[model samples]
Target chain A: MNALPAHVDIREVGPRDGFQNEPETISTAAKIDLINRLARTGLRRIEVASFVRPDVIPQLSDGVEVLQGIDVPDDVSLMVLVPNSKGLDNALRIRETFSEVAIFVSASETHNKRNVNRTIAESMADNEIIAKRIVAEDLRCAAVIATSYGCPFEGTVPLRHTLDIAEQFAAAGAVEIGFGDTTGMANPAYVGEFFTAALERLPGVEVTAHFHNTRGQGLANAYAALQVGCTSFESSFGELGGCPVPAGSTGNIASEDLISMFHEMGVATGVDLDAVIDAARAAQTVLGRKLTSHSIIAGPIDWSPTADAPSCR
Target chain B: MNALPAHVDIREVGPRDGFQNEPETISTAAKIDLINRLARTGLRRIEVASFVRPDVIPQLSDGVEVLQGIDVPDDVSLMVLVPNSKGLDNALRIRETFSEVAIFVSASETHNKRNVNRTIAESMADNEIIAKRIVAEDLRCAAVIATSYGCPFEGTVPLRHTLDIAEQFAAAGAVEIGFGDTTGMANPAYVGEFFTAALERLPGVEVTAHFHNTRGQGLANAYAALQVGCTSFESSFGELGGCPVPAGSTGNIASEDLISMFHEMGVATGVDLDAVIDAARAAQTVLGRKLTSHSIIAGPIDWSPTADAPSCR
Candidate 1:
C-alpha cells in the first residue's frame, strides 16, 4: 500500500446534507446548536446549510436562520450549498455568514437532470457562472461532482466523464473538487484508481472524497483514498444524509467513524473523536431515533490508564 | 496499494460464534437450516457448532444435533469449535459429522484466564493435546488466537506474542491459524503490519483474519488484510458474534458485506451474494429484530438492464 498522509482535512456536512434528507423538519435552533457543537470539535470546515427553496426542501427551510445564528471559532470555515445562480444570490445577501460556497453537478446526465431538472451541460454552464461569481466575491468556491463513482440511474459511470466535469470546474476557478459516492456504490479498488487519475488530471485542486455507508464500504473506500494520498474528506455526524430517492439507502459515512479510523491509523485529523460523538448523540436525541453510527453505540477506544485492565471478552 | 488476490477463501463462523452470543436459544432445526443455507452460498467452510458445556452456553448446547442435522454440498467443510480435550472428545464421538475442529486461546494472559478460567500456558497445553487428537483422527485442525490484535483487558498485544502463539499452533499439526480482533481495537495500519509479519512467519498455514465491528473498523481491517495478501477470513452473517463482555460492542463484519466488497473490487469469493443475503434475511427473521448488515438494507448493486435509469438521488 502507498504511504498514508500524516494529516487530512475533514469538512462536516451534517447540517446541510444530513438534515435535508430527514422526513421531519429540524428546528433552526437545533441546526445552529449542532453546527456550533461540530465547529468546536476541531473541524475546520462545516457546511451549515443549503440555499435550496423552502418549498422544495421544507426540512432546511430555516437555512438562512441557521447560517445567521451559528457562532464558531475563527478558524472554522463555514460553508453553504448553493444549487444555482438564484441560490447563490440568496446566500450572497448574507455574505458574511459563511466563508465558502459550494456548487454541485452530477457526473451522469440522468442523475443531473433528475436532481436539478437540468441536463449535465446546462448544470455545468450554470455552475461555471456560479463558480466565477463566488470567486469574484472573494470567498472560497468548492465544486462537488455527485455520482462520481457510479450512478443509481446509470450504473458504471466512466471515469473520463467524471474527470471531464472536474476539469471544467477546476478551469472555472474552483479551489476544491469533491467526488461524491452519492449512493455508496464505490469500492476501494475503484476508489484507488479514480483518485489516482483525478489527482493527476487536476493539479493544485483540493481533491476531496465524499462517501456513504449505504452498503458499508464507506470507511474502506476512505482508507483506499488515503492510501493514494487524497487528504480532504466530507462526512456527516450520526451517519445521516441518505439519498432520498433510494428507499433503503443509508447515510454518509459517519464523521465520528471516519475520525476514529484516521486516529487509529495514526493519521491526524485535528478532530476530537469524543466531541464529535457527543454531537452525534445530540443528533440522535434531536431526531428521536437511533442513528446508524457505530461509534455512537460503542464509544471511542477507552485510552484511560484505568481502562487498560478491562475484563476479558 | 498492493494488488489484491484474485480469489479468497471465507469461513462462515456465525453458527458457533454468533449463536453462542445470542440472548435467545435457537432451535437445533433453525441452526441446521441456516447452516444448510450458508453451505449452498459457495462458502466452503462453516463453523457449525461448539462443544462448550450446555450450562455455560445454552444457546449452542445442541451442537451435536446441529452437526448431525445439517445437509450440505460435498465441497463444503463443516467445522466445530472445541475448547479442550473434553470438548474434542465429545466432538470425536460424532467424528463423521464434521471435517474440521478449531481450538482457541487468547494471546493475553488476563483474557485467557477471564474467558475460559485458565492461564495462557494451561490453554496452550490443552490445545496442544487437542490438536494432536484431531490430527491423529485425520481431521483438519484450526487454531484461533483471540485478542490477537488488542486485548480488552491488556491493551496493544505485541505482534510477537500473538505470532508466537500462531507458531506454536502451526507446529502442533494445525492447518490454519486465525488472528482475532476480539474487541475491535485493531487499526488498519496495525493490521497491515501484523499480517505482513504473520504471513512471513507462518509459511504453510492458512492465516485467517477475524475482526469485530465493535468500533466500526471491521471492514477496514479486512481490507487491510486483503491488501497484505492475506486471503483467508472468518465472518458472521447479519453481523452477528460480538464480544459479550464489552457492554456496547457490535458484531463481526457481516459476511454479505465482505463478499459484496470483494465482488465489487473484482476479487472473487466464490460466494453467491444474493444467496448469502437471503441467509442474512433469514437470520433477521429468526432473531426477530433488525440486524446491522448494510447489504441487507440496500441490497446488492442492481446490475440489470432496466436498473440503468434509476431516479436521481
Candidate 2:
C-alpha cells in the first residue's frame, strides 16, 4: 500500500490547461513567469503550453514565445498538447525546446465530434498516426483519454468502452494512459471502481487520474484513486479550465489544492506545497478574479484559518 | 456494509435549537404551528422547546405556552431541553404533555463553564439527578453530550474523556444518548473514529451524531459516521442553532441536506425527503431569512441546480 503506483505525479497543467480557458488574453511574460514559478516548485512534469491554432485559444497564442522565454530546467519533463496535425506541426518546429508532446482522444463519439470534429474511431486512428510520428521523431507520446469516467452528453461512459480505448492507446505504444473525468461527475466510489478495473485490465500502462472539482467532490475522488493505487494525477494550478460542455464552468481540479491534501495526508506528491500556492496566487492576479483553489485562500490544512484571506461574497 | 442505519431518527431541534438563538420573541402560535407542521411530516421525535429561565434563554420564554398549544401525537416522542433543577421543575410541569426530555452536558470543562456556567462534574451531577427524575416520572431521557467532536474554548476532547462522560449517562440510566459537534469543528475523520470508539466502549447505548456545517464539512462528516454504522442523526430543519462561542455564525447541519445525501447514497433514513425540503422552504416565511441548507434553495441534488443558494455574505 505504501509503495502505491507511481507516487501521485501532479502533472502541472495550469499554464496550458488553465490559461486556455480564460477569455482574457494574458501577456507573454506572464505565461512564461507562471511556468518558471511552477518549475521552481519541484513539479517534475508539466504541460507548459499548447500549440493550438492562434485564432482558436487566443490566450495561449504566445505558446512559442512563452517556451523560448522561460528558463525551464532540463530535469523537468515539459510537454504540450497537440490537437491535430497542424498543432503537431507547430510542436515539431519547437520540438527541440521540450521533452514530450501529448495527444488527446475522446472516448465518447459525441465529445470527440464536438472536441476536434472527429468520431471516436477517427480520433483513435489520428492519435495512432500522431503517436507513431512523435515516436519516430525521438519523442515520447502520452495518450490523454478524455471522458473516461463520464460524458456530459451521455450520462456515464461504459467501463468497457473506456477500457477498450485505453487498451488501444497502450497497444499503440503510449508511454502513459491518463483517464479524464471531463464533466467532474466522478465520485470516490466510481474512482475506486474505474481504477481498480483499469489496474486489473491494463497492467502494463501507467494510469493517471485527472478530475474536476465542479461538484466539490474532486479531492475525495482523487483520494479514492490513491486508495486503489494510482500514483499520477493531472490538475490545473488554480482549478482553472472551463468545461466544454457546461458553459461558463471549470474542468480540472486545482494542483495547489490536490498537493495540499496529499501533503496533509502524509502522502508524497513531490511538489513544493507553499510554492504551488504562491504560483496559483500569481495565476489569480493574471486571471483578474479570484479562482476556486482552496489552498490559495484557506492556506494549508495545517495552517489554522486566520481571519485573513478576504472572505468571498 | 450497505445496510445503512434504517430510520435515522432526526430529532427535529428546530423549535428548541432554532428559536433559542434568535433575539426577537416569536409568538406562541408560530411555535405551535411550526411543531404541528413538523409532526405531520412523519417526524417521530421533535425537540419542541426548552425549559429555562427567561433571563437565560429569552427566546424560549413561552416554552410552557408552546407545549400546551401544540397537539402532541401519542406515538411521536416530544422532547424538551432542561438546564438545571429550576428548568427541571418547569419541564416536570409539562411532563404530562410530552413523553421525552433531553438533558445536555458538555464534554469539555471550559465549554461547560461558557455554555451553562458549570464544570463537567457539576453538570454530570445535575444531569444524573434529572436523569433519575425523568425515569421516575416514566418519561424517556436522552442525555446529549455537547461538544463531543471538539470544543471552541478547549480544542479536541480526547476519545477517553468523551466515552467516560457517555458511560456516566448510561450508568445514570439514560435510554438514548446524543453527541453534539457544538463548535462545528467535527470533520468526517473525527466523526468516524469517535463513533467507532464510542460503540466499542459503550456497547448498546444508542448514539446520535449532531454536527454543524460551519466549515462545509458537516454533511460529509455525517456520511462518514454512517460508514462506521452510527445512524441516528439530529439536524435542525434549517441550520438553526447558535454557537455561544462564535456569535453570529452557523450552528447545525441542514437537515434537508442530510436527508438528500442519505437518500442519494441509498441509505434508508425513513425521512420523507421531499417533505423535509418543503418544511425548510416553509420556514423561510416563518423565520424570515434565507436558509443555510443547500437543498432548500438549490432544490434536491438530483434536481439540477438552475439557481445557486446565496453565499453567506
Candidate 3:
C-alpha cells in the first residue's frame, strides 16, 4: 500500500447517527451541547443532523432547529443527511451555516425498499434531484451508499452494484462517495480487495468508510481500507447507533475507539484524543447509559496503575 | 497471501484452555463429556489436560484421571502440559496412553517468573530438560511461549526476546513453537507482520497462534496469522480467560466465535458450526451464566431471514 495521506478526516456522527437509533427523545439543547462538545475536540467534520421528517425519525425531528441554533465553527465543516430534495432544500436553507451536505442512496435493492420505501432505482433517481440542490448551494455533495458491502435483507451486494451507485452519484454531481457497511458482513480482506478494485473502476473518487461494529470487524475493515489507501472514515462517539439489522447489534465503530487505533498506529488524525473521550463521556450522561466503547471504559492507551480509577459513569 | 491451506489443524484445548478459567469444578464426568463431544467434532489434535499441580489449578488437577478415562479415538492425538519433570513424570506414567506432551515457557523475563515461577534463563534451562525427556519418551513436544506480543508489566516485548525463545525451542528439538499473545495486545497487522518476520527468522518452525481478545482484536489477529500462513490457533470456549494485563478483562475470543467467522468466510476449518454453537450454548449452561459470544447471541450467518431456515443453535 502507498504511504497514508497527510491527515485522516474523522467525521463525528454522534448527534445524528448516535441518537437516531435510540428509542428516546433527546432535547434540542442537549443535542446542541453535543455538537458544540464534538467541535471542541478538534474534529474537522461532524455529521450534525438529518433532515428526515419528525414522524419518521422522532430523535432528529429538530434537525432544522438544531441547524439554526448550534454555534458553527469557521474551519470545521458541518454535514447533515438529506433524504431527498425536500430534505436537501431544508439542508440548503441552512446551507450558509454548514460546510458540506451529504445525501444517501441504499445500494441493496431490499434495503432500499425497507429503508426509504423506494426501489434501488428510485433512490438513485432521488439523488439526482438532491444533488442539484446541493450543487446550486455551492456545497460539497457526498453520496453515501448504505449496505455497500452486504445487506441485512439482501445477503451480498455485488461490487458492480455499489460502483454503479457511485457512478450514478458522480453523474449527479456528487464530489465524493462514502460506503456504509450497514450490516457488519464486510470483512477486512473483502473490503481491502474491493476498495482496490473500486479505485480502479472509478478513478479520483474520494471514498469514506462508514462501518458498524455489529460483528466487531469495523476497525479491522477500516484498517484494511486504509491499507488500500482510503483514509476518510466516519465513526460515532461511544459507538451509539447500533446495528439496525434484525439483531439490534452494535453500531458504527466507536469514534473514541477508532481515533485511539489511528493514533496508536502513528497516523496523524489531528483529533484531540482527550477531548474526544470527554465528549463521549458526556454523551453517556445524556443517554443515561454506558456505551459500548472500549476506550471510554478502559481509558486511553496510556491508562494504568489506577486502572481502577473511580468510574466516570 | 496465497490460498489458505486445504486442511488446517485445530487443537481442541477446551478441556485445558476452556476449563481452567471456569469457576467450577466441572465434574470429571462433565470434563470427560466435553472431551467426548469434541473428539466427535473431527478435531485431530486436542490438548486433553494440563499436568499442573492440583492445588494450583484445581480445575484440571484430575488431569490424569480425565485423560485416562475419556473414550478417545486413536486418530485424535492427546496432549497435556508438563510444567516440570513432575508434570512430565505424570505424563510419562501415562505415556502409553497419551501421544504428545506440551511444555510452557515465557518469552518475557517477568512473565516467565509470574507464570511458571521461573526466570527467563531458568525457563530455557527447564526447556532443555523437558524437551530431552519428551523426545526420549517417544512423545511430541510443543513449546508454548507465553506473552510473546506484549507483557502486562513490561509492555511491548522486544522482537529479539520472542525470537530467542523460538531459537531455544528449535534447538531443544521442539516439534512446534506455539506463540501465545498471553497479554492480548496483538493486532492483525501486528500478527501478520510479526509472523511474516518470524517465518523468515525461524524457517520450518510449526507455529500456533494463541490470542486473547482483551481488546476485541483476537479473531482479527488470528485471521492475520492465518493469512501469513500460520494455521493452528488456540481459543477458549465461551471466551473465557482473564487477561493478566487488563484486570478483570475477558479475552480468549470464544472458540465458536472464531469458528463462526471462518465458516462464514467459506474457510474450511472442518468444524461443524452448528455443533460448535451447540457446544458453546452447552458451555453457557454449564457455566450457569450468559457468556459474551457475538456468534452465540447474534446466532450465525444463516441467522438472516434471506438465508435458509435457521439451523439448530
Which candidate gets the maximum DockQ versus the true structure? 1
Which residue pairs of candidate 2 clash? A8-A231
lDDT of 1 by residue, A1-313 (tens): 5678999999999998999889899888888899899999999999888898988888888887887788899999999999999999999999998999999999988788778989999998999999999999999999999989988777889999999999999999899999998877899999999999999999999999999887788999999899898999999999888563356667699999999999988999999999999999999999999888889988887643343454434
DockQ of each: 0.57, 0.13, 0.22
Q: Please give me the DockQ of candidate 2 compared with the native complex.
A: 0.13
Q: Native contacts recovered, in order, as a fraction for each?
A: 0.51, 0.00, 0.07
Candidate 1 C-alpha lDDT tens digits along B82-148: 8888898899899999899999999988788878989998888888888998999999999999989
Quote the lDDT for A193 in model 1.
Answer: 94
lDDT of 3 by residue, B171-219 (tens): 8888788888775666666777788778777777778888766555566
Q: List the residue pairs that clash in candidate 3.
A: none
Model 3 residue B290 distance off true place after TM-score fit, in angstroms: 2.6
Interface RMSD of each: 2.8, 9.5, 6.9
Ranking by lDDT: 1, 3, 2
lDDT of all the models against the reference? 0.88, 0.74, 0.75
Q: Model 2 Cα displacement at A203 (Å)?
A: 1.9
Candidate 3 segments whose C-alpha is farther than 4 A from its true place = A1-7, A68-73, A303-313, B1-7, B23-27, B72-74, B242-244, B303-313
The residue pairs in collision within model 1 are A153-B308, A153-B310
